[model samples]
Target: MSVSNSPNSIPCLLLAAGRGERMRPLTDELPKPLLTIKNKSLLAWHLEALSAADVENVVINHAWLGNKIEEALGNGSQFDLNITYSPEISALETAGGIRKALPLLNPSDYFLVINGDVFSPNLPLQGLLDQVSALRSMPNQPLAHLLMVPNPNQHPEGDFYLKDSKVTNEPLDGAEKLTFSGIGLYHQELFKDLELNVPSKLAPLLRVAMAKNRVSGEKYAGPWHDVGTPQRLQELNAAHE
Candidate 1:
């Protein structure tokens, strides 16, 4: 299958290295991404979405029950996608996992990154590309763009504050707060400062960049599900079914 020609035909980084401590027993048998929801693995849904968006290549970082994921998906050719696995001895946190897979990702264009457990409807890839293009057009501009969503029931306090489509680390004091939808388009240069193999979290990276007003975000008012706990997984299964 030929991928549609698009400026956002960038590769993706699927962060699947977490232990899925919240999804316990089910995770004991399979990785969270492999847990079935509506007769499809969580990772499968993500792959389909990426394929639809004209994304041709993906880098999957796996740890817990990692072999099962690889054995199931193989090289992604089944989906007409090329997949490269970044296997870690132990689960590296988000920023560290991304840093580990940096070599697999293109160091030129902006790439999409998403958590393995969260599920959202087809993302607004074109809209985000427009944001990236707009930012790149400006001199000394933002290098990261995030998809911000309304605070979900599980996280009422929210994650980040969005003002003028820009994300900030500062907590919202009696204001509408939104969560960082676990999806983002990031430029390769965003990780330039971090030395190779350094353990880190994505928040600090966003904070420094955001303080410089170099982080932009767009609110997504669409169907989004964070299947973190078994209860939530059941809810997602029932809802989607």
Candidate 2:
């Protein structure tokens, strides 16, 4: 799908509320997003990526060492991005965290969401926008569009299947499994009828949309890493550096 060349002012929500259980000691002193990679914090790198894509506003949710993260990157003016924090007493899972940050997101427009701990090659933001547009064009469209990637070494079976640009929770027969790339474009409609203050998992909500052929996706054949473990982070840092 072709996307418009003009840069869009899409806002981004970065999920930084994890406890980093696998990155214990390192995270004991600092949040995983604050870990130095080539003298730059992972959070900083993500901000730079967003800025390069012309994304201006960013909502970051935090819990572990949350205050320190806010102190380190105040208002995000330094990165040419406006930053807002959603402080949570208890770390909410992806869906819950996003719901908590909804107040900071675009009130009536589609926005971007990504896992804060993972790293990926320069994202095709335009392609994501195209998917959102396509979904909105259809009658009674879905609320989200995901960016998927071919199965990585760690997750060979993958998390979900993609066929004909639609997502499915059901395992496909002899289908090439693909993993979610931790990056997505989402419309506010996904949470339209959701009650506030209730914890939710994004997967089930997405699956519902997929069942109706509302959720859309595109396979991204690019460098992607889900740095969920210390060993994996070390390997990625070494290889990328």
Candidate 3:
């Protein structure tokens, strides 16, 4: 669990386990993270971003077509990062997959996690790193800190509300309902009790933490794409082309 490249480095886990059912025929042959955009794999883009962020270690969890991910990324040397894979026989959703890979992560009390499907090139890791340091020093630490954004057309209702930098389930008077960017920093304790290899969703855990006022977040107005459908993927490629 000591994934640090140094005593202070924060390790990151990239989630790549979803079946991408909406992506169907394309995902039939390749995992969603392996789908290309502007000639680069989705996972590759994150790897490069992480490397640029100075995050030296990464643990990627994959299920469908997992081997091909290993084939394409190998040991992560190309990206100047230490890449480790956590293979799942079946997609274990979000929380379960994190529980399964906890042992492979840096047990620095808190660690970074990013969803592999979303494209948010500007999602700042340094800010998350600074948060990790500040939170660690607090006598009462929050379970997670999320990056939120205005509801995208695909998810108009949004997921949670963010008020004064706090994430909440209800639309509190001053809270702004927003969508989770799938980028966060979580304390290891959040997944400590979760059963490994079992399918579990992240929303329930986050909601529970929100009820306890243990979740915090920020709104990000930047380029982001979920790429859930084939059309979105095509649009991204076409725009770049």
Q: Top model by lDDT, which number?
A: 3
- Return whichever of 1 and 3 wins on TM-score: 3
Q: Going through the candidates in order, what is the number of backbone clashes in each?
A: 0, 0, 0
Model 3, global lDDT:
0.88
Cα error, candidate 2, residue 160 (Å): 1.0
- Give the per-residue lDDT digits (tens) of candidate 1, residues 35-141: 87889898998888887667888999999989999999999998889999999888768888888898998657578898988888676656665565677686867
* Candidate 2 local lDDT, 1-241, one digit each (tens): 1122544567789989899988887888889988866677778878888877767788999999999899999999898888999988888677888888888886466889988887775766656755655665778676677889988887887888888677788866654568998898887777776666566778888888877777777799977778778888788779878
Error of 3 at 52 (Å): 0.6
Model 2 is weakest, by summed lDDT over 10 consecutive residues, at 1-10
- Model 2 TM-score (2 dp): 0.90
Candidate 2: regions farther than 4 A off: 1-7, 171-175
lDDT of 3 by residue, 53-119 (tens): 7888799999999999999998899998999999999999999999999989857688889999998
Q: 1 or 3, which is superior by lDDT?
A: 3
Residue-level error in angstroms, candidate 2, position 15? 0.4
User: RMSDs, each prediction?
Assistant: 1.9, 3.5, 2.3
Model 1 spans > 4 angstroms off:
171-175
Model 3 residue 84 CA deviation (Å) reads 0.6
lDDT of 3 at 233: 94
Clashing pairs in 3: none
lDDT-wise, the better of 2 and 3 is 3
lDDT of each: 0.83, 0.79, 0.88
